[model samples]
Target: MSKHPKPNALIWLILSVVVIALDQWSKAWVLRDLPEYTAIPVIEGFWNWYRTYNTGAAFSFLSDAGGWQIWFFTGLAVGISGLLTFWLSRAARGDWRQALPYSLVVGGALGNVIDRLMHGHVIDFIQWHWRDHYWPAFNLADSAIVAGAVGIALFGLFDGKRSKKA
Candidate 1:
């Protein structure tokens, strides 16, 4: 009988823990130190540390849906995180390309879920602007989610091409 090395990427979950810790810590700092709705310029004419809250998804989508969105979004994030975690458990230890993105997304999703369950909304602070036009405020969790998503898409595309070539 030949022995097999079942090295799974569960170790990558450490990155998820780090992301959650940072996201929660920054949100706590924002709540303690920042003034709500006031923009404090971090980079003159470009970025600001703006405290805000969102009850909905990105860009405040369905934020005013009469409080039901809290459960909706919370459930959705939890489900997605669970799915990604399952994927991580199946991924190979050497497959950082898949493991990394899954970990990031799981961390980001759970981070926001914590806020939703505790405060009924997600805390946001980082803000970007172009002259007078400003972008919707978001937090580190959102950043991780976006980065992970982009990595998944871009890397998956490249991997597909490589697979076809081989």
Candidate 2:
């Protein structure tokens, strides 16, 4: 058998690029038109486009840390994306379960990194809520990251079962 992985292994990179493009484009639209912190409801009491910024990690962790979190999160995203890229390169080409999740994560990380570098914060606009309860604002990059993480977890569960049957 040939030593090289199948071309499909690299196909996931295209999806990653698309995610990055969509994320940046959507953020650009929001930045240009939306007034910061103003909510425009798409679904009454449920969803809204609320432009905001996060200077720290998920859920604004360390957001109030006196501005140092920018570089910290930037560096963290860079490091994580690099590691995921390396992992992707080494993963089996035919294994979509592995390759796709890693690609999603890498795309999401780089997407947010672009925002951090250019705006000094991650632009967030999508908001979901119920009555007084609200989830933190997030964007396309955050969605992809969460989905990818969940996919990886589900893969682990199924893969473990398959391995035991072998």
Candidate 3:
């Protein structure tokens, strides 16, 4: 390991904090402002502010599993976050491309885990639709996780090519 890590690692950490804060804050605001399963239009047909509580994983999978999934998911999130934190601590500080995605994942995981622990379910508020079809409602933490996944994928693809050329 280098004696000094990359400066951008700090930036990644800051970004992770911001993501977690914003995710939790937005969820808090929604809980205070909206009723359960209520939709408030944000962009007419394209988007809306809708509140929902998901007790299961994506798309409400295992949501009706008689409540055992709450602890299971919570445990998974805690484990994943711990592993990510360890990776982040060992990562080169300047390697923002590598660190940022993991940071985002860690932050997002914690954000949702907080909700699960506090409310028995994760709050989701953003909704999108097209014609008669609708996408499942999700929150900022979910967005961050998806974005982080994309970032990591892109970095793996492009960064490897660039490094080999250099």
Candidate 4:
């Protein structure tokens, strides 16, 4: 039998909860304070608080799927979150390289899932645009997920070499 030291799963769980709370709270605040398709400039030419709902996947793919996409995305989020939680449990302490990313992903997935379950779609608000082109609206959770994914990828690339030498 192999004795593996479990990571500080509690920390990950707490962080995940905090992420979910912040994500939900911000969405709720936006829903209450902002109107659909309305933009409130936050940084002039850089960003704005714009309310929009996504019924599809990233970049609004399949957004016009006639509503079936709502359930599909919801289910996908839930599934991903579940898998992340399981992964977190198996992670070893001091393995922030892996656990941190999993935690972030879990948080983001749950955040969007809550929106889908409650609003029948995901509420997005943050907007970025250049002089002419506008980027897709997103929320904090999406940012966290992207950051975590990048961390994981970078760490994997660098850590692989170190592990090979050990």
Q: Compose the digit string of candidate 1's lDDT tens values, residues 136-155.
A: 99999999999999999999
Best by lDDT: 1
Q: Is candidate 1 or candidate 2 better by TM-score?
A: 1
TM-score of each: 0.97, 0.93, 0.89, 0.91
Superposed model 4: Cα runs more than 4 Å off? 1-10
**Candidate 4 global CA lDDT score:** 0.85
In candidate 1, residue 134 scores what lDDT?
93
- Relative to the true structure, candidate 2 reaches a TM of 0.93
Off by over 4 Å in 1: 1-5
For candidate 3, give the lDDT of residue 110.
Answer: 82
Summarize candidate 4's per-residue lDDT along 19-128 as a digit string, tens digits. Answer: 89999999989988998998899999889999999988789999999998888888887888887787777777568888888788888888988888888888999999
Q: Across residues 107-140, which tens digit of lDDT does each residue of candidate 3 receive?
A: 8888899899999999999999987799999999
Top of the candidates by TM-score: 1
Candidates' C-alpha lDDT: 0.95, 0.90, 0.86, 0.85
Each candidate's clash count: 0, 0, 2, 1
RMSD of each: 1.1, 1.8, 2.7, 2.3
Candidate 2: tens digits of C-alpha lDDT, residues 44-91: 999999999999889999999998899988898889888877777777
> How well does candidate 2 score on lDDT at residue 106?
80
- When summed lDDT is taken over every stretch of 10 residues in candidate 2, the lowest stretch is 4-13
